[model samples]
Every structure is written in structure tokens, then in C-alpha cells.
Target: MVSLGYPEERFEDVLEERRCNSDLLFSARRFAPPTYKHRCPRSPAALRRAVLDSPRLQQAIREMAGEDGDTEALRQEAQSILREMGHNQGMTVVRTFAFMLSRIFKALFRHVRVNEEGVQRVQKVVQECPIVLLPSHRSYIDFLLMSFLCYSYDLPLPVIAAGMDFQGMRLVGEMLQASGAFYMRRSFSNNPFYWAVFSEYVQAIVRNGDAPLEFFLEGTRSRSNKSLSPKLGLLSIVMEPLLRAQVFDALLVPVSISYERILEENLYARELVGVPKPKESTSGLLKAHRILQNDYGSVFVYFHPPMSLKSFISGRLDITPFSMTPRHMALRLSDTLRVLVHHLAHSVVLRQQHGMVVTPWSLLTTLLLQAPSDHLFPTSCNSEGGVHLPDLLHDVRCLRTVITKIGAMQDWPDAQSHEAVVLSTLAMNSSLVTLTKEGRVLLNVDKVDRPKCRDDILNRACTVLTCAAYRNHILHLFVRPAFVAMAQRHAGSVEDGPTFSHFCFLVQLFSEEFIFEPGSERKDYEEGLSLLQRCSSLLYPLDSQHHPSTITTNFSVFLGQIFQPFCCSYQMVCNYLLTLEHGSMQKESQLLASLQEFALQQLLEGRSTELEILAINVYKNAVASLSRLGALRRERRKDGVWFLTTSQLHHVADAVASLKPPSQLPAKL
Candidate 1:
């Protein structure tokens, strides 16, 4: 049930990969019956029309129209909006495109491997009840891939909740519509008419159970490639059916799509660093056709076990959307739904439930990004010219052991041996890894082109960003170890590991760069401390005190490299935060705006390209962390001012100085 690799032509390579990694493949057990083709009982167009004609929707339209004092006019307006927002379920077209797009994807990627077992679980859920497939949004291609994956598995194609961006592309829009993609604007909080029409359309689809539903919980692709705070807008609208009892039960399946390389990594990096995003258009898509010619390595689709709404709210509390007489009432109960939406989105980020695929490329990229650019070869391989394969192998084993101990790899039972996993990953990513004439290994990220123009400069920038994006896939897993390493360096003695209070203080400092699991601060602190203890024990077994001297210097160096970029990013942000006028409240957006400018200025001043120091996502995270620590406080939700505490500023400055490696930053703090 491991990913069945892409492209029939490369089927042989898939077979060879399986043969080598057979020890780690998912069981080939068919837990369910072979799935037959499923067709929607009602077309999305028909559902929209029914909702438009529903008495409840008509009443809501009339109520809104009365504000302008024109009920009939508003009714007509509502119908027009419904027509614009509706999705067309062209069954024949969907089937045709499914066949064609499969070929297209196979052509685009070196391999496309679907977790057979995960897909089967989803298929079973499809038969039992309605499903809302909430996958992480990493690329525009996610929308198509979700539907395509369902279609390939003989399950009914999902009605994808896509953004209005795609709706503007004529042929592309029409094709997407024909294949069951419904478009919604990024915002409609002011447009009551559009909101009613859109809400009804989603509810009708869910109620009818004609097709499984799909949407990105994040609302848009994350430029940083990490999970963003979830946007509750669409998820709140879609869950109205369950709230109103129109559907007895709906399963929320959080999907994790891991790519060896992102298709839009360079463009995303550009946007992250303050380049205005180019709007999605037919011409833009056509211009991007060059992507198909390039190899994008492999894509993995892992479906986490689904969550039931009834179970999610069990024994906690209840806002009975049940008491509401109609589906429209559920939409009006925004606060209740928002709480539920947050839980659903947060669950998607929780590692225990999220089905993340850890590939060799991710592992290797982590090592490469962590290692100093100048120190590309292992210390033992100083006379050699390539990568130190043995060191990498050991690190891979260590990472696998760490993740396995924490139960992150439980879903993929076949990924048994860490060595096999690393070997298989290297074999699959043959293009990225190579041995030099001196028999040393090196990642080929240094193929710099002399930029004669802005386009060339941007292109090289994108290349590095794409590589960083891959490394980021495993970045979260390294957070605690990195913190331990950095904190130890600051302690200035290996024998004296930071006190629990000091370690927790360090966690607070790096909060912007890593997301710890949600719990009481004490629980998070304990978990971090425990992980450090485990890692220290594994490396320095003879001495359990986590003494720096007892730990192998090689292991210590590896941990330092892992911790460096985050520290660099933190130092840059803290420097900016310290400059803010004490007691002067700053709006979140305004604070981030200033920080973004500072990041760009530093980039121009020659910052390391090894990490995304200017990343807006990390900047926002730092602000959130500061707020949690009482260094900043929100004055009001919309007041747009975060009160900065001068007293807490000193602590932040101190933490930043301690974590900053002397080699990277000046000694003066």
C-alpha cells in the first residue's frame, strides 16, 4: 500500500524501488473490497439551482434585500449570484479529464505514489458517510491532485472549493468547472448575497452526498510551505450541513501531500520576500507551461485517518446548530462554527494525526541545509571532494529513531529500517546526489549561473528557495534538538545543560521558527526537555547528565548546524523588535510590514541564503510568540495595535544574544 509510483513508463523504476525498500513498504493487504466507479446522484449545477430555489434561501435573500428596501430585486440578484457561484458536475467531462490528467501528472512528475492503504480507508469512509478532504495547501496543483486522486481510486470526484483566481481563466475555468470545481471569492464578509448563495451551495452538496468534498484548510497555498494558521471561512460554511442535522455524520479527513520538490517553489519564495504575487490568469498558466518539461521528482499523498464531527465535540461543549430550524441559521452562528473550524484546522497540524511522508530527499536536504556551505564534505573526508555518506547515514538513522520513538511514523508500518529508507530515498533522488571525481558526495545546489539580468538573479534565488522548501518538510521535527543544541552552546559548558526554566525560556525565544504541539506550556516544556534527554542519552550514553564534553563533538556539531538557521532568523527578528518604541502599540500587520522591509534590507546587505531570514510567516510567528510571553498584548481584535512591554524586551534581547552563534553574527549584541 505504499505509494504506487507515477508514469507507467517508469513502472520498472517503481518496481525496483519497491524491491529494494520492500522491508519498509505498506502491507499489500486489501482491507476493503475493490472500489467500483462512483457517480454523483445529483449534479453540482442541479444542487445549486435547488438551493437558489429553496424557500429558506429566498427568505434570506428577501431579508437582505429589505435593507435596500427592494425584496424582489434582491431575489433576482441572489439568483444571479447563485448562477455565478454554482459548480457544474459534468460527469463525462470529469471522467475524460481524469484519464487525461493522470497521464499529464505522470508526465510531469518523475513518480506519483499514492498511499494505497490510506486511499482504501478513504474509500471505505466514502461508502459509509460523507467526507470532507482537507489537505494541506502547498501548491495550486493541490486542487487538481485531490480530485484526480479520488477519481483514480474509482471514488466519486470531489466538488473542489477553489478560489476565484481560477474562475477568471476562461478555458481553464470552464474545464475546472466541468470537472466539479466550485469557485469562491477570497472574501465576501460584506456581501451578504454572495455569502448566502455560497453557503447554500456547499450545504446542498454535503447534504446530497452526491460527491465527497475537498478544500484546503489553510484557504491558500503557504508560501513558506509550513502550515499557516487555518482560515475558518470555507470550512465553517461547508460544515453547516452537519450542524443543522442535514447530514447524520461527516468525516473530516486531514490529508498530507509531501512533495520531493514543489512546482512553484521559486515563485512562492519571490512572493514571500515582498514581490507582489502575479494574479492567476490564463496567460499566466500558459506562460508556466515550461514547468511540465522539468522533472519535479516524486509526490506523496498520505490520508490521515478521518475524524468524526460527533466524536470531536463529544463531552466538551455543544452549540446546538441542531436547535436551528434551517441550514441558514448555522451560518449565522459564526462564533460556534469558528471554534469548531479552529479545532479541525489545528488537528491537521498535529503530527500524531497528520499522515506526513518522510522521504530520503527530505532527510538529505535537512543535512545539506544544516551543514555549513563551506563544510560540505565530512571532516573525515577532508582529503576527499564529495559528501560524507557515512555521516549522513548515521544522521538519517538518528532522525528515524527520534521520529519513531515519538510515534510519527506509525501509519507507514512498512518503513521498518532507517537504513533502507535512506538508501531508497537516495536511489529515488538520483539526480540531486552525486559523487565527485575525488569520490566525495555533494548536493548539486551550487550550480550558480552568473546573472546578467534581473530575471537570471530571480531564477537563481528561486532555485535556492525550492531547495529550502524541501528541507523545511522535516524542519519541524528538528526544532527541539536544535533548541537543545543552541541552549547548550549558550550555557558554555556541556556538563551544565540549561535548567528546566532556562530551557523553557529558550523555547519561548525560538517560538516563531517552530510549532510545538498544543497543550499547556508546562506539557510543551516537558516534551521538549524529554526529547533532549532522549537524544542526549542516545549520543552520550556513558554520561546521562547531557554534559557537552561527554557528547561526541561530531554529534554536537550536527545539532549546532540543525539549530543555526533558526537562531539566525530569530536574531534578525529580535533586532527589529528591539528597535520598536517601548510602550507604543503596533498593529500586527504594521509590525510585520516593518519587519518585512528590514528582512529585505538585510537580504540586500548579504544575509545567508541558507535559510529564509526574511520569511513573513516566521515574522508573524515571532509576534504571536511575543504576545504569548506577555511581551506584546493585543489591544483589541480590530484595533490593530499590539502593546509592547519594555520590561520583557530585555529578556528577548538576552535570549537572542545567547542563541546567536558568534560565527554568524557580530559579538556585539
Candidate 2:
């Protein structure tokens, strides 16, 4: 809801409005309420054409390619190809390769083991009835991993509905088709009909055993590094068909995927912090291809127990489209995703927290590299080493405990070496900058992670800002503005460009001083102030009177450390900010403010210590739940920001008021 130039995509309010549209609700005379029973979709090919002509398809194409991008013609052609190439046999082959590749990467990374729990449930259900594999969506690799795991274990291959934007070359499209993937326009949630077509197609797949379907119930990659709202557009569409044929028995398998040290996570994190958005250019895709080629991460999938809707159709259990429709499916999906997130944060991601109680290596590496300005790690953690930094090893003890809790999971390898590998991978950086010939004691950090001191605490705080706790605290009273009313309508790209990258580069540039080699006379505090000064350009001040103890020095000292000639950077950001005098930069300042508000609240709330907060996935899971609820209603703020659906207005108002316990939620029944 900050004035930053980004789309105010309020999902909840939209869902509410769409649901309560009195006109549509009363349209029975025109199209008639759907009949209770479904038949084989009439000439399904005709339905495909209707889908091609849907408004959503036209709108999504216009979003990226402009009004004259041959939207209609392309849709028609796409559908023609889909119809002609409908059922594919190679789903098995692609799935096999995908699983083999994933397993290969896991071994190469020496990651925690992948133990498929609830294996019998998945197999038994698949044997009894058709299934829809609704997994929590994570990365691009999610598609292949799910398919491979299914077929490799003797289950039939699953058809995935992937974004058309990712289809790439014709061959890739063909490959996906053969792998049982159907293309969907990336931004088609708004247009009703295409969703209808896509829904029906999935319905067809499930109604018959043409292909069991796979879905990332959460719509997209979790921005907060957890699950996202399960976009219900498809779910709504599939309902009528299921209701009609009373094939109410189809099972929904909840799949969860966890990763250890995802390569693209840093890129996603960068985008979150305010980089210029990148376009889908050839170079970008090529970059994605290169990352995929590395295959440097682990993939773990757990199949939660399946839920069948058959009992409801037989008049045994009550079903409200919202509450019980996919209750079991959603819960298990949410829980599994949450576990995956925590596993990565505590056991894999390389960073430090207050009271982290880690091994000497983790503490040493963090302390040496953590100096805000100094690129190097201090030579040793002693007064004799110069600069009396805090006792890092003691500080990190709590962090180690979180890791231990993470490792306690059933899927974690029951071996210590694997644990070490998982931790090392989290700390790995492609580039090495060493100040010492022996590369010991202190000096330059792993080149890759130096992109920014990036304030590890701040990053976690920002990611958690989506939490109900933060939303209730910071965003509750500050309502969003309407899209059309926004000061600068539409969003600006923050995924690319020198604007933000320069900031990261400066963080990295200053990190060099952390290791300052043995003889360098730079004090740790001095190095910090310098780095702070260089980094401050990327930040702005707020409520000067309420400055937290975390910042214990005067502004001038900070300035000196940043601008000194030895500082690494094209130039310090603080200098640039003061020079530009862009007063409106406060909008660019929200994440930090958001983080400050969140961190302070968490401290006051006494829920979890900082390291425990960093390691937990609860924040992300709550955000996903609320986001899903938010998307189903309509509401807007005075500043043109979209808010929770008016119906869910109370939910936000309540959550904003306090971080209520799960028991605080009202009874659904």
C-alpha cells in the first residue's frame, strides 16, 4: 500500500465482487443455471474455440504484446494445435527424465533426503479413482519433479497446465504437450471464459482417465518464499462438471515441494527489494536456461493424504464451495509447504541471527563477512584481532537449535555429513575474494553473497511483512487506493536496472573491508559506518525521534565511513541521495520501514526470538491463507490500493488489530 509504483493487486475484494455480482447471479434466464448433471462436454472442440475467443485471453495478450499482437488469431491457432495434439504418450518419458534429473541434482548437492511419505495413500487413491495432483507451486522445476515422481513410482503421468509465456520455442511447446502440459495465458484471471475453458479441460481430464491433472493450487511462486493464494478460478470452473456427472469421487492429492539453496531465490529476493523489473527478453530467458543448466538445488516432494468429493455427491457430507470443497487438500498442502519453507530457512539458508549458537565455521564466516562495510571477515574473534566485535559463537547458538529442529524432520537425512553439505551449500558463493594468501582467518567474503550486506534481518523482516501480524499492525489502518485513483497508475518494474543493482553492488563493494587483510587499521565499527553510509543512499530516514538502539551513532560518523575514497563502489548511495534531494523517495523507503515496524512488533509480542522468527515458516503460511481469502472479495483504499474483499474487510480489520491465535478464527461451519 506504499506509494511505490506497483500494481495494487487486491485479490480478496475482487473475489467478493465477482461472487456477489447480482447481475451474474440473476443470469439464469439468459444462460440458465447449470444443469445438475454433466455429460461428455459437447464436441469439446467447440468449447475450445469458445475459450480461444474469451475476453481474458484478449486482455492478457494485450498486457504484454499490446492491442495489435494478433491476440485473437493466436488464441485460435493455439487452440487448434491443442485440440489436434490433445492426448500425448510421452508424458511417461518426460516424467522419468525429470525425476532422474532431480534425484541426480539432490545427490550432487548432497542435500537432505527426499522421503515420500503417504506413499500408500497416493497409490491407493490413484488405484481407486481419478486424481488431481494439487501441489504447492515453487519454481519452474516443480512441473517436472511432480510428473517424474508420479510416473516413476508407477502412477500415471500427470498433465500440467503451465503459463503460456514460459512455453518458449515451438519445440518446447511440443515437448510440454507430449509431457501432458497445456498452456495458459499468465494473466488471465480476470477474463471469465478462458478460465471456464481451461477448467472444463481439466474437468475432461479428470472425468475420464485421459490424464490425471497436476496443479499448483497456490497460483504462483510465493513472493514471501512460501505458499501463495490458491487461485480458485480453475477450481470454480471444475465444480459444475463434477457436480453434474456425480463423478464426485475424484481425488485431490496435496503435494508439497521443498528446496535446499534454490539458485533463483537470490534473484527473486532482489526483485522483492526494489530492482527494475526485467522484460521477457531473449537474454533473460537465456539466463534462466543457464541457471536451469546448473541444476544446483535439491527438490523434495511429500504427498499428503488425498481427499475425495464423492461422499458429498452421495448426500453423505455437506459441501460448501468455499469451506469443505478442498479443505483437506488445502490444509495438507499448506502444512507441507510450510515445512519445506522452514527446512530451507533454518537448515539451508546461510545467514546469522541474534543468539544463533552455530558452529565456529558458521559464526566465523558470518562475523567475518557480516561487517556492513568491510568486504572481509575479521581475522579472528579476539580483542587482539582489532575491534571488539561481539562474541559471535555465543550469539549463534539459538540459530543452531533452529537448524537442529529443521533437521529433525522425517525427510532430513539421518546423517551428519549431509547436514554439513546442506549448510555449506547455503553459504556457497561462486566468486571468491580473499585478502590473505592462505585464505584463512579473515578477509573478503564469498564473492556471490557480497551483492549486498542486504541486512539479513531486514530481508527476513520484509519477507514477513506479508504476515497477518504485520498487516494488522502496519497496513490495517492504511487502506489501499483504487487502481485508477493511484497517483501513478500501473506499476513500475523493480526487477532490473542499475537503480537498485547499484545499491547491492555498493553493499558488496564495502564488504571488502570486513577482511581488510591483517595489517589494515580499519576498525570494525568504522567499516560498518562506512558501509552504512554507502548503503544509506538506498534507504531513507523516518521518525528521527524514535530512532532504535540498533542505530547507536550520529549521522555524521555514518557519512564519513561511507564516502572515504577506499570505499568500494562507483560512489556512495548516501551522497547520491542527498545530492538528488528527491523528497518523494519515502515511497522507495517502505520495505525498511515495514521491516522496522515488523521487527519492533515481534519483539514486543514476545512470540519468537529473532532467529526463531527467521527459521519459522508460520509467517509465510498465514500470508498465503489470508491472500487467498483476500483475493475472493473486493475493496479499495483511498490511495487506489486494492484491499481485502469488502466481505473480508472484517478479517483484515481483525488480523490488523492483533496477531490472533488459530483458535481465534471463527467457526467455518
**Candidate topping lDDT:** 1
Q: Write down the TM-score of every candidate.
A: 0.77, 0.47
- lDDT for every model? 0.62, 0.38
lDDT score at residue 369, model 2, on the 0-100 scale: 28
The positional error of residue 558 in candidate 2, measured at the CA in angstroms, is 29
Residue 158 lDDT in model 1? 76
TM-score of 1: 0.77
How close to the true structure is residue 468 of candidate 1, measured as C-alpha lDDT?
69
Question: Of the candidates shown, which would achieve the greatest TM-score relative to the real structure?
Answer: 1
What residue runs in model 1 are displaced by over 4 Å at the alpha carbon?
1-40, 319-340, 351-353, 374-435, 439-463, 480-517, 520-530, 540-560, 580-597, 600-611, 624-658, 661-669
Query: In candidate 1, where is summed lDDT lowest over 10 consecutive residues?
Result: 4-13
Cα RMSD for candidates in order: 7.5, 20.3
Q: Write the per-residue lDDT of candidate 1 for residues 1-669, one digit (tens) a residue.
A: 232222111111222233343221212212223322332555555686688787668778667766568777777887777666677877566656755665567667766666666677787777776778888888888878877666546666677888888888978888888888888888888777677777777777777776778888777787776666676777777666666666777788888877777888767878865678998789988888787776676776767678887677666546474546654443464565566567666666653224556666666676555544434422332444344555566556565565555444322326467556656666555445555556345544444322233354344445445556777776666566555555566676544335445556766665545555444346655565566666555542222332111113334445566556666676777788778778776777787888866765665445544335656667777777777776666575555456565678767667666665534321100
